[model samples]
Target: MVLALGGLAVLALWGLDAVRIQPNRIVSGTGHGLIEALGTGPALLVMLPLALVMALAWRPTRGREALMLMLVTAMLAAMPWALSLFIGQFIDDPGGAARAAVSGASWLVGFALILMLIDLRQRLQPGALVTLVLIAVSLGSLGVAFGRGALDSLALVQEYEVRRAAFAEAIVNHLILVGVAVGASLVLALGLALWMRRVAGVRQGVLGVLSFIQTIPSLALFGLLLAPLAWLASRFPLLSDLGIQGIGWAPALLALVGYSLLPMTRNTFIALDGVDPDVIEAARGMGLAPLQVFFQVRLPLALPLLIEGIRITTVQAIGLAAVAALIGAGGLGTFIFQGLGQAAMNLVMLGALPIVLMAMLVDALLKALADAARRGDADDRTG
Candidate 1:
C-alpha cells in the first residue's frame, strides 16, 4: 500500500501539471509539469526522498518508520516552496495580475504523502511526543514558508493577503459557533439522557425526536428557524438590539445546537447505562453510598465513551457551522460562498483549507484523549 502511494506521487509529479500560471486570478491558466516548474535538477531532487522511502518500505525496520516519516515530512514541508519555485520560474509578471495556482499534480502528490504519514502513524501508534513532533514539523515548516512571503505569488496566498483580517475573523467566528454549540448541546443532552433514564416511558420518544431532527436538511432547518426568530425579535425589543435577528447568528446557533444533541445524548446515555452492574454491586459491597458509587465507580469507566461522543459531535458541528455562513453567521465559509458567487476558486480555498485543518485537529486531539482514557481503564483493571 505504501509503495503504491509512493508510485502514485511519482506519476503525478513526473507526468501531470504541477501548477497553473494564470494571466489573471479568474482564469485557470496554463499547465506546467514538474520539470517545467522546477528544472530537471530540482525535479530529480524531489524524487530522491520518494525513492528512499520506497526502498525502506521493501526492507522494513522499526526505526525506518521514523526515517520514512522524516522523508514525507520533508516532502510536505517543501510543497508550498515547490509552488513558490514554480512561480519564480514560470510567471512572467510577478508583481502584476499574474499568479500561480496549484493544480492536480500538486494536490494529488501532497495528499498521497499525507496518507502515507497517517498510515505510518496508525501502524506504529506512536506516543504523544511523536505526534506533537509530527504536528510541529508539518505546520511549523509550512507556517514559516507562508510567513516569509515565499508563496506571495501563489493565487491562494494572494487571496489570503487581500483578506487577512477577514480571514482571522472568520476563523474566530467558526470556532465560536462550534464551541458554543457543542457546549450547549453537551449540557442539554446530559440532562435529557438522565431524564430519559428516570422516566422509561420517554426513551423511545426522546430518541425518535432526536433522530427526526438529524433527518432534517440543514438548509431547510435554517429556513424553518428564520420566522420564529424574527417573531421573537419583533416581540422583544431587547432581543432585536442584541442581534437576534431573522437571518443571523440567532437562528444559526439554535440550529447548530439542535443538530448536535442526538449523538451527544445517545452516546452519553449508553456510556453511563452500559457500566457493569456487577461492578456497581461490588461498589455497594464496599459499603459506599449510592452517589459515591456512581461517581467513583461508574463515571470513570464511562469517560472514554463520553469523550468519544464529544469527539463525534464536535467534528460534526465544525462542518455544520461552516454552513451557518449562509445565514449571515460569518465564518470561514463566508469565503467559500463568496468565492462561489464570484467564481474565485482560490478564495474558496482560503476558507476551506483552514476549516479542514480545524476539523482534523479536533478529531486527532479527542481521539488521543479517548485512547488515553481507555489505557487508564485498563490500568485500573490490572492494578
Candidate 2:
C-alpha cells in the first residue's frame, strides 16, 4: 500500500517525462513530462486506472490477482504507445535532428511499475511468474524495436551505435576477466579452505592474509600489481606476447582475484568446518575411507555454501570489472568513463545499467543453484 501510494504520488505530483529530447548528440536538452509528452488525455487514461488498481491491491480480495495482472498488462500495453507518442512529437519539430533520451521521471515510473509487478509475482506460482516474465520481455523487446529510431536518437544509444564493435568486445572481455578471476579464486580458495580445516595454525594465517588483502582498496590493489607485472613483462618477451601487460588485463585480473579470495575462502572454510562431526563419524563407520568420507560426505554437505561463496564472488567481480576499464582493460566501464568525460548522463547509464543487470542475473542464477542444493540436502536428511 505504501509503495503503491508513493508511486501514485510520483505519477501525479512529479513530472513524468519518459525521455528527453536533444537537438543533437552534443546538446543536453529538456524532456517532456508524461502528461506533456503524451498529452493529458492519454496520460490520464493510463495513470488514473493504474492508480486505482494499485490502491485496490492493498485489500485482500478474490480479484486481487486479477487486478494486479490487469495493472501489469495495462502498463505493458501502454509502454509502446507511450514511447511512440513521445517519439512522434519530435518527428515534426523544427530541429533537423533530435535525440530522445530516457528521463529520470520515466525511470522512476518504470522502476515503480517493475517493483509492483515483482511484488505481485510473489503471490503467483513459479510457472505463472515465469510466463509473465517471458511475456513482458517479449513485449518490451517489441516496444524497444518499434522505438529503435527514437532510441538511436538518444545520446547513450548513439554512443553505443558509434562503438558497437567496442561494446561487443568490452562485454566479452568483461566476462572473460570475471570468469577467470572467479574460477581461479574458487579453485585456490577451496584448496586453502580444505587445508585450513585440518590445520588450525595455518587457518588463522591464511585467513588473516586474505582479510588484509580484502581491506586494501580495489584501485590500490590494481596499482600495487603494476610494478611486478611490468617487470615480468619486460623480462620475458613471451609474457608480453601473451598480453601480460602491466596496465591491462593482467593487473586487473590479479586485482579481481585478490578481492575475490576473502569471500571464497571464508565461506568455504566455514562451510567445511561447520559440517556435522556425527555425520562424518557415521560415514566412517559405513566403511568409507578418509578420502571418500571427505569427498562424498563433507563436500556434498558443504556444496551449497560453497556455491553461495561463488555467487558472492561472481557478483562482486562483475561490478569490479567495470573499474578495470580505467587501466585499459576495456569493459562497460569504458562507456562510463567516456560518458563522464563528455558530461553525458545517458551514456553513463548505458554502461552502468548493464553491469547492474548482469550482477542481478548472476546472483539470481546462483541463488537458485544454492537453493536447489540446500533442498537436496534437506531431502537426504529426511530420507
**Local distance difference test scores for all models:** 0.90, 0.79
Per-residue lDDT of model 1, residues 53-156, tens digit only:
99898877779877888888887888787678667887665667899888889899989999999998887888889878987888888899888878778899
Instruction: List the lowest-lDDT window of 10 residues for candidate 1.
Output: 86-95
- Give per-residue CA lDDT, model 2, range 1-383, as digits (tens): 52464466466424656677887766887777777655778767657756666567667465776566556656655665566566667756422467677777666766666666666666654474676564667467545655656344555666677777988888888899999999999999989997997788898899899999999988788888888999999999999999998989999998999999999999999999899999999999999999999899999999999999999999999998998888888888888998899887777887898899899989988998999999999999999
Q: For candidate 2, give the lDDT.
A: 0.79
Residue 119 local lDDT, model 2: 60
Q: After superposition, how far is residue 163 of candidate 2 from its true place, in Å?
A: 2.4
